[model samples]
Target: MGDRWQVEVDRGVCIGSGMCVNHAPAGFTLDSARQSHPREPETDANEPLLTAAEGCPVEAITITLLTTGEAVFPPEE
Candidate 1:
């Protein structure tokens, strides 16, 4: 219903900790076979994808707003 946000995971940096999945199950899922390979779904740009990015222990997830070109980085806190 709104502009979709995209999520990308850098497997080279991911540790398969499952934090992203736990924090935002609707947006991210684990590959299981290759646990570090995170599968992210299309999400509403207004949703909380940034929260999930921050939840990743390895900071592997990146959230990009398709409409505005705005990107959210993981919070330091």
Candidate 2:
């Protein structure tokens, strides 16, 4: 099986920048309030998805290895 990731967006941190949606339209969506949400919380580890998480200005998006809960973005220090 391919790598799977658990995606999360912290609405409190999100600034409604829409950067995540621009980076990965298939992986994320913006609500009427402009909060970003993962189309599927558990999804394949795709380039665009990673880009979206990295592109987030506030680092609101987080990606983790679904099976192990290892941080994939804003990697643990």
Encode model 2's per-residue lDDT on 1-77: one tens digit a residue.
89999999999999999998899999989999999999999998999999999889899999999999999998999
What's the TM-score of every candidate structure?
Answer: 0.71, 0.97
- Please provide the root mean square deviation of candidate 1 (C-alpha atoms, Å): 3.3
- Weakest ten-residue segment in model 2 by summed lDDT: 49-58
List pairs with backbone clashes in candidate 2.
Answer: none
* Clash counts for all predictions: 0, 0
lDDT of 1 at 72: 54
| Candidate 1 lDDT tens digits, 1-72 | 666776678888888887777776766777855454435445666444677787777788877666765665
Please identify model 2 stretches exceeding 4 Å from their true place: none
RMSD of 2: 0.6
Alpha carbon deviation, residue 17, candidate 2 (Å): 0.5
C-alpha positional error of residue 24 in candidate 2 after TM-score superposition, expressed in Å:
0.2
